[model samples]
Target: MGASQTQLRETLDRLGLTVPLADALWVLDPAQPAPSMKTLAGQLHCDPSSATFLVTRLELQGLTERVPDPADRRSKTVELTDKGALVRGELIEAMVAQSPLAALGPEDQAAALQLLRRALAQAERP
Candidate 1:
């Protein structure tokens, strides 16, 4: 699908996130229960070195912080800072405001959301 890169760029610009796609993905997964550099790398299908680089950049920007896992001194966990939370909230609001759901009639939007929930149910498959 050749979607609108222009729209995508404009949307990202509105959100003030200049990171590339991989870093964007990392930002989106901020609320995972136990997020880590390793987990992010696995999700992005990138190498550990690349993941580290992404994490370092985000950390430098103050969007994320690496805290030592209290239970394991050798391990660390990644968590979004207050700034990240605010950015995520704004991004989500912008997305919802621009999405087709708002333009669709209420009845149609409800039906579409129901189908989307059903599609979400397919996550059980391996």
Candidate 2:
């Protein structure tokens, strides 16, 4: 897992992204309501201040933007820009290319995915 993370970081660095920012962008759904800062913090398992800093960096890079939350006029939500989505796609491709699963056959990959999903689901349970 550490080696995989290191490879992902190297790929992201080549594209001018940090792991946190890439993670934040990857979680966003273009067709869904953008998550509020607090929600993002919860998703990232970080404090609100850290989420704010990450968002600020993404905003400066023109990869993300903050808009007024319709549900709460005083609050804001973060969404990916067109550029961010493109970059995120590239990141996905790069990560997949570097993945150990890349060497597996399609059937093996499917099996692996199923097992991994099962493990994740079990981990999520109490």
Candidate 3:
């Protein structure tokens, strides 16, 4: 979904969250399986200290928890708790509702997604 910075900020405020924390939640997406906390830090472009802070906040809210990485016992992965999933859903719904993309039907949204994917692919090219 599309949204302006102001909208995002407002939404986060309504959810009692900050911008970085919201971004962390989005990156901690359940679709890709559990990505390591290091990966999460990289995705957020934050230092280890910042990542620790974000994780602490998430844990305090019972939204996400650190689990032992399946591939590496020494590492941990961030997994969304059931409560986190529901909250994430609410955030997405709020964003979508505030976005112009909400007016588009499924077919139109799919076409938009296709275009965005193409744009992203092109942007990634050297």
Candidate 4:
């Protein structure tokens, strides 16, 4: 079969994250400036403490920052710094580079995308 969640987790761990899903989400939403921990925890389906711990880990790596939320002073928001952005870009690029059709010519790549889109559409059906 295709890659399982565990396999994806391992790949993410290899790239230097204890919780790859959370990190990847933040990276993908870089325009957030700084997303609140509550928001992130909700997105990850985890408790606030767990999100705190993950953010701490990323902060220690100079990949993310925690700042006071302007909208709600009591809340804190997390954002990727310059280093974080660089690492995020690299990680995204690496993942894309490893795609199955990476070696295909442009026409074949287009066909592959079309096929994958159809599969995705089918899977989204109830």
Q: What is the C-alpha RMSD of each candidate to the true structure, in Å?
A: 3.2, 1.4, 2.3, 3.9
Once fitted onto the true fold, the runs of candidate 2 whose alpha carbons sit more than 4 angstroms away are: none
Residue-level lDDT of model 4, residues 42-100, one tens digit each, is 77777988888888888888888888999998988888878878777766665566656
Q: Residue by residue across 32-78, what tens digits does model 1's lDDT show?
A: 65466676677667787887777777677676678887777687767
Looking at candidate 4, the ten consecutive residues that score lowest on lDDT are 1-10
Tens digits of lDDT, candidate 3, 1-126? 244557677778877777777888888788888878788889999887799899899899999999999889999999999988887887877777877777899999999999999999999999
Error of 3 at 4 (Å): 2.5
Q: List the residue pairs that clash in candidate 3.
A: none
RMSD of 4: 3.9
Best by TM-score: 2
- Global lDDT of model 2: 0.88
Better of 3 and 4 by lDDT: 3
Candidates by TM-score, descending order: 2, 3, 1, 4
Candidate with better TM-score, 1 vs 2:
2
Q: Given candidate 1, what's the lDDT at residue 96?
A: 64
Give lDDT: candidate 2, residue 76: 97
**RMSD in angstroms, candidate 3?**
2.3
* Candidates' C-alpha lDDT: 0.66, 0.88, 0.84, 0.72
Write one digit per residue (lDDT tens) for candidate 2, span 1-126.
667678788788888888888788777767777999999999999999999999999989888999999999899999899988888789889878988899999999999999999999999999
State each candidate's clash count. 0, 0, 0, 0
